[model samples]
Target: MKLAMKYVILYVNDFEQSMRFYRDILGLPVKMEAGTYVEFDTGATTLSINTRESVNELLGLGLTADVPAASSFEVGFVVEDVAAVIEELRGQQVPIVREPVTKPWGQTVAYITDPDGHFIEICTAVG
Candidate 1:
């Protein structure tokens, strides 16, 4: 079987705040917005945001009373300066899960959880 990842949907509590983070702060290019859904162009893949209930229903996970605090997957993005990114996020008063730190994989990584508590990693690979 051949499978390709066309989209990554994130569950967000506040749509506008999440959209602002993904669009303005993260700098992902917005493709379209319809009601509660917003799509972004993420180079080879697409990023989307929708309500938790809708996502759960689509995944066949039954109806969930509330969205989980965190996602099972860690979404990563390469960055030039993980530290700078952390600083910028801090300046904006964004919640920081883990401060900029070097990982065992030789990457300067910074981790943060989105409004819905999905983990996001910003890292710079060390050669």
Candidate 2:
């Protein structure tokens, strides 16, 4: 079986803020934008942001805009230098959930949480 991940959807409170953060700060290029939705091209995958209420209405659920704890789900990015990325993120005032640490698997990683509390892991494999 061949499986591939296509996109990741983030339910956000303010689409504009999230869009700016992802596009301007994080440097992801915008692919599409509608009234309350924006999509960014992240190499092979896409990152989409939608209003919380819109998501709930589309899914027919009662999902709220309350950001959950950091342990919910993590987005990992393979970086050339995890430390450098972490430093840049810090300079941008992005919340750093965890400082850079070397894992037992011989990888260096740092964790950051987005405005909605979603975890993002910046990592570099030991060579």
Candidate 3:
């Protein structure tokens, strides 16, 4: 049997700030929310955010969102215009990890980190 993915959740330090980032900044609609957990509608899979403190208390794993290193994975978004989205994000004082650049494969991409230090890639569809 093959395993199927359901939802992706990022345990964040500040729940309100992260909700603002995805809800207001990135323009993702909220699909569901309960307590400190939230799920965003991405038109495909659901992207979720929750408090690290809650997860730790529930699982006893002692997870922390304070790591200084980059995570091994990134959440990517395909947009119509890379530069326009980047400009909008910059206006909200979000720090850009990389300016929009066209890759050799013909996709214009830029990078930014979420409130939880998760890498978010905004790019144009590959042509």
Instruction: Indicate which candidate wins on lDDT.
Output: 3
Highest TM-score scorer: 3
User: Model 3: residues >4 Å from true position, as ranges?
Assistant: 68-70
Q: How many pairs of residues in model 2 come into backbone collision?
A: 0
Candidate 1: regions farther than 4 A off: 53-65, 69-71
Give lDDT tens digits, candidate 3, residues 1-127.
9987778988888999999999999999999999899999997789998888998988887877776533778999999999999999999999899999999999999999997678999999987
Comparing 1 with 2 on lDDT, the higher-scoring candidate is: 2
Cα lDDT, all candidates = 0.81, 0.83, 0.89
List model 2 lDDT by residue over 1-127, tens digit each.
9989999988888777888788887888999988788888887988888888887877876767665633588888788889899999999999998999999888999999777777888889566
Tens digits of lDDT, candidate 1, 87-124 = 98888777898898887878898888776778998889
Itemize residue pairs with steric clashes in candidate 2.
none
Compare candidates 1 and 2 on TM-score and give the better one: 2
Model 2 misplaced regions, further than 4 Å: 67-70, 125-127
Worst 10 residues of 2 by lDDT: 62-71
Angstrom error at residue 25, model 3: 1.0
Alpha carbon lDDT at 111, candidate 3: 97
> What TM-scores do the predictions have?
0.82, 0.88, 0.92
